[model samples]
Structures are given as C-alpha cells and as structure tokens.
Target: MVKKNNASNKSGNFKTNTIYAGDCIEAMNRLPEGSIDLIFADPPYNLQLGGDLHRPDNSRVDGVDDNWDKFSNFRAYDDFTHDWLKSARRVLKHNGSLWVIGSYHNIFRVGSVLQDLGYWLLNDIVWRKSNPMPNFRGTRFTNAHETLIWCARSKDARYTFNYDAMKNMNDGLQMRSDWTLPLCTGDERLKGEDGNKLHPTQKPESLLYRVIMAATKPGDIVLDPFF
Candidate 1:
C-alpha cells in the first residue's frame, strides 16, 4: 500500500493527502489503473546548465546543474519524457487531466510528445515571474516565464475543473493566459543547513495552491510525477 501523508493548509483546510518521495513512475504504476484525478509534472528543463552562476551584484543564482537534470541529448531526453508520460496517462482516470510545466528549452518537446502520446491539449498557461532575474551577461532578453500545458487523457474525457475557485483566486478577473507571480522567496523557501537553497528547483507552493484550486476539487487525488 502506498503511504500517504495528510497535508493541511495554514488555516486547517483539508483535502486529499500527499506522498513525499519515490520514483513517481514506479509509484504510479503501483496504483490501480485509472486511479488518479489529476497530474502535475514539473520535470527537468534539460537546460544543460553547468557550474555555479552568480551576478555581478554578488548574489548567487541556483542553476540547474544536478545530475538528474542531465540527458545525453534531445533524443534521450525525449525518450525519457515519453516513457514517463505514458505512465502518467495510464494511471490517470479517464475523466482526469494533466498539467506539465517547463521552460522554452523543453516545453515544445513536451507538447509535441503529448500530441504523439494522444493526450488532448486544453490550455497552455504561461507563468510570468513578477521578479524575474535579469540577464547579467546581457546576451539575450531575460527569460521571464515558464509554460504549463493542461490536457485531458483523451478528447472525450470529462475532466474536473473548479471554475468558481479559479475566478475567486484571480480576484474576479477572468484568469488570463499569462499569470504574474513572484518566485519563491525568503522563509517560504526551503534552505539547506549551510543556508543555501534546498532544492535547486523547488517550485513555489503558492503556484501549486492556485493550480490545485483551479484544476481539482476537494478529495480529488493529484499526482506529482516529478515531486
């Protein structure tokens, strides 16, 4: 049996719990087929980033140079991506949906793979960081946002969508294609014992809160494949 940890909001609001660690593909395979309500994947960007990067201002920027982010090449990366996506689709309920986030370096490839795998596209959301890091090298326009693609398991599946909750969270405005939010900062961010960032790419919880509130309902099981 998969062990689940119950997670609560600061106000004690309740919902389906979560699992902290494991190979998500193996974990998903252990689930009964068609069991998950939704999936949110924030896979590696395949940036091929190397070494530590710092700004002239002396602030250190966490580049994604982890071994897990490495791929021999695009073909290898695509193969890995396709394999996991197949697992995700098999575990998702027929009426369930998926959300995947990535930068320009990988989103196009991911979207293409989704099409090949038969996942029906819904909306592609752009998360625009409110305080994006500037291009200190001044080589190109600062990469300011990441893209998230929302899709259903198949064309005819009836996916869960919390329409009202999304509207409220957007402050009554129609939630646009682009979302402007701050990157993880300060105490809300996890840190290592030496005071460095915990995970080089730990996603913002507020971003997740919005995603869950918008895409799922209470009791709906959400699977984070790359969590």
Candidate 2:
C-alpha cells in the first residue's frame, strides 16, 4: 500500500513500505533527519532526442520521451540532481547507503554531483541487459548497459554489505561489478488499460532484488525517491 505523510510528528516518526506521490525533494524534506536506512534512485536521463525513432521495419520504437525526462539544459539538470542528492543525504542514517542508476547520457554528471555532496564512492556497477533492444538505425553500437553507483553516507561510515549472501547468490563466487539482467518486459512490465507500459523506465525487479539483498538485512528500510 502507498503511504502519504505531510510532515513528521513531534516525536519525528516516519512511515515505511508506503509509496508517496509527489515531488521527491519535497516529500523527502518532510521526513525526519536520519530516518532512512537505504535509498535507490532512478532519476531522469535527460535524453535529447531530435525526432521519432523507428526500427528497420518502420515500426516506432518506444523510447524514454516522457515529459518528466525533459530538461531545459545541462545546467538545469545538474541543479536538479544536486538538490535531490542533498535532500537524500539529509534523511539518510549515518551508516546508510545510496544507489543511483543512469545511462551514459547523465551518469557522469550524476557521479560528479554525488562526489561534490561528499557521498563516498563504493562501486560503480554495470547492468548489462541480456535482451537489449537492437539499435535499428545502426548509427552506434547497441546501447546494452546502464550504470549504477553505490555509495555510503560518508567515508568512515560502517555500512552493510552482504558479502556472503552475494557469493552464495553467485554460486560461491564473489559477485563482481558487472551484473547481467533482463529488461522489464512480458508480464513483468506493468501495463495500462491500452496495453501500453505504465512507466517507460520501469526497472526489472530482479535488479532491485539483488541490490536490496546485497546491501540490506531483513526489516531494513529501503527508500526509492523516484518511485
């Protein structure tokens, strides 16, 4: 169920496992400081598409052209990134960790802002899509992977990392920086009444499952600011 809260009480209580619908910055600001244990953000990629994209068969490609993904310019996007990252840091516990995923169009900028905000870098993971959509235009190599940045609240913070669980998940071998997963499609993709995808950039649950399992223990609060 989705939870909605306007503000914290005098005792500074925050709700968990509830989805709130609103501007992420404002919603996060309403929470008490140090209330969140972990955060996973999938922000806008600011893809500047010149026109419609089509496959070699002349069928239209469903790209990330949603209005929310649009931005005025690089500076505007950078400012938005900084504001939300700062807000996320404020609500995170001292030992909490954060994960942000993005494509090449904006990962570099996001990484720079994360560093500027003093978020200690842990590892930059690459999610290689097993069944990525082919680049029909053939203008560039098939865009097959996205990047995920993991970081702690600060450099000295002792954060959670389930090393053994990850190893077990990998069949006794240590999990590496590159993860191979499939895109959200088939029955896993949430659809609208018209049979269209409800959310264009919905990530695969398998990806989030591994991330949450590797970084958090049972009953840990995991926040998704961009949900």
Candidate 3:
C-alpha cells in the first residue's frame, strides 16, 4: 500500500500507508496506543568512529560516520535507545512484535534496553554478509555479520510467526538463526547527487523480505521508526 498525500494525524488515530516525519518517540506517542502490528527498527547504531579509516592503498574508506549515528557517550546512547524502545512498547499491539538490527557496536546495549523495558526475549538471528567489507588493517576478523534481535510484546503475548513460509524459503529445512545474504549495493542502494550512498548502513531488501514474511501477514501495518 502507498501513503496518500492527504493522510492526516487525527487524535488517537493514524491513517494507513503514511510516513510520519519527526523524532520517532514523539511520532509514536502521538499515535493511538497499541495500534501497530509490527515494528522493524534500523535505529542509529552510534558507531562512534575514532578517526577516518583507510585501506591498504591509503584510499579513504567511507564508513558509518553519519551525524545520526554519533552519540556523546554510552550513557547518552543508552538514553536514546531507551526512549524510543519505551515509546515503541507503547505503540505496539499486545500481540505485536519488533525486530531490531545492529552491529556489535550497539546491539548489546540495545538488547539490555529492550529487556529492561519488558520485551520478552526471542531469537537472535545472525545475518552473514556474503561480501562483507574486510577489516582493512587486519586488526580483527572480517566483520562479516550483523545481528537481528526479534522480540514479542510480552511473555504471554501470542505473536505472528509464519513457520511454513520461512521453511519454504529454506527449501523445507527448518529455518535457523543464521542467515546468509549480501549487503546492499548496486542500484538497490540509494545514492546522493554526488553518487555516494545516501545512508551508511542501508540493509538489503532480501533481508527485509524474510523479516516481513516471517512476522506479518498481508495488510498488516508495519512501522519503521528510523526510516
């Protein structure tokens, strides 16, 4: 479905197929409580790069150095995570769930915040990048994967999970926590006027296809707070 140009934000209501533009917490708070079916969050990872990176050839590396991904400190980052997750909890339907993707730099902190806010722990999936960028300096192993944490609203909430669909994608084998997919590249990656990628951590559409299919049905309202 597509967002209509005239979609309005009426009190305690939200129009379907629309993108609300603002701080995620503020936007979710304004919506009627417990209205969303699924929330797929690609929130700021707070990369906090120490300095510019370079390759063996001394060519500069384009990395996640965006303003949105920078925070003053761990505490500041935790606070930001807490506020949005809390608001996300508020807007989720009782049986609603959320999926959060991040790298080691911030995923652990995000997990802590999620549990502190009472989200029941679910599976933590590993997204293995077939073409991960190498650790240029050889300081560490190739950062070949990212993590996706899926959670239910509460321990008792009955959430959606299409087992057959996921199995089908796996050729009838039971789907596992580790998934192999390529990084976003080529025409699928949104580009700026200068021909550089618009977002540093753009996820591949293939990854999202699995998530949406496994957790939601047709016509379900899905929200991506950080889009």
Candidate 4:
C-alpha cells in the first residue's frame, strides 16, 4: 500500500501512511480540502515553563523546555494553535472527525477555540494515568490525567462511530468518557545515548492503538498533523 515518499524509508501507504517529520500547518495546506477522513492531533501543551525546573533536592526535573515547546506567551501559543487547527479543518472531509489531547494547562482554551470555530463536540474524554508523577513538593494534587476532545467537522456532518466495536473491546460494556491507562514505562520508553528518554512527550502506543482502531476502519484516511 505504500506509495508517496514524504520521507526516506517511509512511504505514505495508499497516501495513508505517516509522514515522519514536517511543519504540520504547511504540510496540511498542500492536502486538498475534504480529503482527510479523520485527524488526531497532539499539539503543544503551552506549559509556559521557564529555566530549569528543579526538584527540592536541586536536581533538575526533566521538562518540555525544547524550542518546539517555547512560545512568546499565551497569546502567541493560542495563535499558533488556531492556525494549525484551521489548516486541519480545511483538509478534513465533511464527515471527518478530529481528536486532540492536552493537559489542564491548555485544554480549556483549546475547547473554547474549537467551539468558536464551529466544530460540534461529540465527547470530552479523560485519559487517567495509573502511575502519574507525584507532586514532588506536595504543593498541589498530582496531575494524573489528560483530556481529549472529539468533534465532527461541523454541526450537521455525518461521522463514523463504531459503537459495537467499542463495546466489544470494553469487555462487552459500553466504553465511557474516562479511560484508564498507564504511561509509557520500562522498555516502551524511548532512550537516548545515555539511556534517558529520547522524546520528552511520546504518548503510549497502547493509547494510539485504541484510538486508531476505534475511530478508523481498514482503509480510512487518518491524518495525524503532529507526525
């Protein structure tokens, strides 16, 4: 099924395979409108963290302090999000749906902007992590979950829903909005040269496996803007 070559050693399967790396907004602009069947985006969280966030022991806690995570401020981040979302919308088929995941730091603003752009919300799912990081300083409760927003392209768009499949996957029960899953650990975690994490924010493959299987059919075109 592999065909288009956006990157070496990776072919776009029937124009459906993943593109390894590129600017999402610019890349999406090249795709024809109403071409994508579904979209899954994991945008920057706008954590707004600065300097080296350290533990009480003075050792640095690994944080998303990369260039990609940096923005001038909240307004700048919002604008960047809006631009990419608009591009995503343009490429989505009328019946196509989208799912975006984010933490408390940014999900509210994302949802508000999505509503303002006329996307009809289908559900807001909470992905609860079983072994979440504790609040080291005990200043607040442990941040243990992330939110995912599911929506259709527009109010009257016809979208795909696999109710029976979801039920079967959930031990013959209907799956709810709250999903309990574990964070990537042990061998699943990507390591760098020093045996540390290579990617700071690689989501668990299990989460994606469920999401893709639940939302897509064998040949459905899935657009992952975040790559």
**TM-scores for all predictions:** 0.88, 0.95, 0.94, 0.90
Point out where model 4 deviates above 4 Å. 1-14, 55-58
176-227 in candidate 3: lDDT tens per residue? 9999999998899999999988888889999999999999988988989887
Better model by lDDT: candidate 2 vs candidate 4? 2
lDDT of each: 0.83, 0.91, 0.91, 0.84
Q: What's the C-alpha lDDT at position 108 in model 1?
A: 100
RMSD, one per candidate, in order? 5.5, 1.9, 2.0, 3.1
Rank ordering of all candidates by TM-score, starting from the highest:
2, 3, 4, 1
User: What are the runs in model 2 whose C-alpha is more than 4 Å off?
Assistant: 3-12
- Report the lDDT tens digits of candidate 1 across residue range 1-227: 55554232112222235564556565555666877888999998899776667899877776878888899999999998998999999988999999999999999999999999999999999999998889877889998999999999999998887777787878897777788888998998899899988787777887898788887877888878776
Candidate 2's residue-wise lDDT over 64-116, tens digit each? 88888999999999999999999999999999999999999999999999999
Q: Which candidate gets the maximum TM-score versus the true structure?
A: 2
- Clashing pairs in model 3? none
Residue 18 displacement (Å), model 2: 1.0
- The number of the candidate with the highest lDDT is 2
lDDT of 2 at 125: 98
Error of 4 at 66 (Å): 0.8
